[model samples]
Target: MNIGILSDIHIDREHPEPNRVIEGLVNVIEQRGVAIMIIAGDIANDYERTLHTLHLIEELTEIRCLFVPGNHDIWNEKHPDKTSWEIYEALKAFSGNLVNGPVALPNGWTVIGDIGWYDYSFGSSQYPIEQFDQMEIDDRVWQDKIKTDWGKSTIEMHRYFFGKLETQLSAHRSRKIILVTHVLPLSDFTVQRPNRMWRYLNAFLGSKQYGELALKYSVAYSISGHVHDRLQQQCQKTVFICNCLNYASQWIENDDPVSEIARAFKTIEI
Candidate 1:
């Protein structure tokens, strides 16, 4: 079976013609003969658009689609009455293929995933907790802190999801597991020796605990996207993949968004 993987589409941040971009992506997946497609997250910052995007993909393509929510996807800006967890619950109901639990594929692979929020573990030791807490001092105030209300600290939410992931991993111990998350799982995947700005921001990228869990469970393949840079690497028994079509502002010279989507949405045969 062939499975396609892509993430961080960020339709809200993309060019004006998002539907066209989606159509282009669908064509690429169809041409590749992909049976299933996994979108790691950040479909849109707006909840309704996220649902609309998923519905659009399902409506336009024959390939089965699976997804997990990104931090941006759960932002409660417009809906002040709802918490991040509440927003996640609503998203789960809307996303028929939300892979928070175990999903057995036709090819005998078990897929498991969650939003996988981060802890400050990825931050450099040079910086202290106070710095991360007071994000404005270093100009690192991410909108996630203000928009998302999980009713728990970042580390607490990370632990909560980690426990759920462990349960899924243990249940599917005998099968080849494909784990997915919206945030980076390993510090090794961070930009090599990041500058001062990136170093500080890395705190919100991901938690090393997720990588440790992947290793502990011996996952066959792990997928994630938050960082716009596309990368893949092998860590022991697991191959980690991050494929993202970030905002046009982040694109390098001569990089077309549609073409980049075609190049980044890799089809893996299992």
Candidate 2:
């Protein structure tokens, strides 16, 4: 089976029309001959755009698509009446294929995932809780704190989702497991030599415990996003991949919407 992976499309950031960007993405997926698509996260910033993107892909390609929400995807500022958990439920309803739990694919692979919020364990130990807490006053403060209502600390959410993943992996021990999340699972994938600001902000990248769990369960592959930088690394039997399209402003020369989408998406045969 050929599975296509992509993340952080951020359709709302695309210029002119988001529909055009979706058309390009569809074209690239068709061109790559991808039977199943795994979108790691950050498809869009809000609910409507996220649903629209998913609907367009399902309608146009009719390929089996599995996705987990990015932090941006659950942002609640636009819809203040709803909590982030409610928004997540709405997204799951919108995309019938959303993989918050384990799903057995016809290809004999088991897919399981969630938004996978972070626990600040990715940050340097030199920084105390006060330092991390004080980040709110600096530019490093993430919008997630204000936009989403997880009803628990980031660490609690991380442990909760990790528990769900552990249960799924245990249940499907004999099958090939493909774990997907919106945030990077390992600290190795984080930016290298990041500045003070970026270093402080790294707390939200993800938790080291995810990587540990992946290795413990011997997952075949772990796919994630959140860090815009691309990464591919092997930890024992598991392969971790982060393929992000990032924002238009971050794109460099010769980067068109279609090319960017194609470049960010990686096809793997399993």
Candidate 3:
């Protein structure tokens, strides 16, 4: 089977409407003969819109669309009345959501996913966890601080997610695991820029504990997003991938939806 994987489309930020965004994705998925699509997250900022778009993809492409909700996807931006945890539960209940349980393939392969939270382990050594706890610096705040409220601390969420993921990985120890997370797992995938602020902000990018889990579980593929950069790296026995379409403003080369989708989209045999 050929699986299409990508993330961080941020439909609301990339386009004023979902039509063009949906069209772009469908084109790439069809052209590549994808049997299924795995979106790691950030399709849109609202849970309702994100769920709608996920369904729309399946409706148009006629294939299963499996996904993990991105940080942006769970934001109460549009659904302000709904708490982030409420939105989280909603995404988990969606039919195609991997969060409910593992999806098994015929070839002894299993796909497991979650909107994994972040720990400050990725922060620069210069700053203490206290600083990252502020979730702001230089008068700029991490959107999640405003758009999301996990109702728990970042590390608490991170540890909670880790426990759940570890359980899933343990049960599928004998199978080839395709672990999907909206936030990254390894610091190796962090942006390479020398921006000083990234030193503090990187804390929210992901957790090193996930990297450890990958190694401990002997995962075959680790897919993630949220950094808005395209990166692929081999660490030990696991292959990590992050491919994001990002916002239209970041489309420095060309803003054509189809073209950008093709550029960020990736397919792999399972």
| Top-lDDT candidate index | 3
lDDT of 3: 0.87
147-180 per-residue lDDT for model 1 (tens digits): 9988787778889988888888898888999999
Taking all chains together, the TM-score of candidate 2 against the true structure is 0.95
Which regions of candidate 2 are displaced past 4 Å?
Answer: 95-100
| Cα lDDT for residue 150, candidate 1 | 82
Per-residue lDDT tens digits for candidate 2, residues 134-249, read 54635546788778887887778888888887888889888988988888889989877877776778888998888988898899899999999788999899999999888887
Worst 10 residues of 3 by lDDT: 12-21
Model 1 CA lDDT for position 25? 81
lDDT for 221 in candidate 3 is: 90
Report RMSD for candidate 3: 1.2
lDDT of each: 0.82, 0.82, 0.87
Model 3 over residues 89-150: C-alpha lDDT tens digits? 98875788888888987689999989899988888889888888889999889999999978
Runs in model 1 lying further than 4 Å from the true structure: 254-256
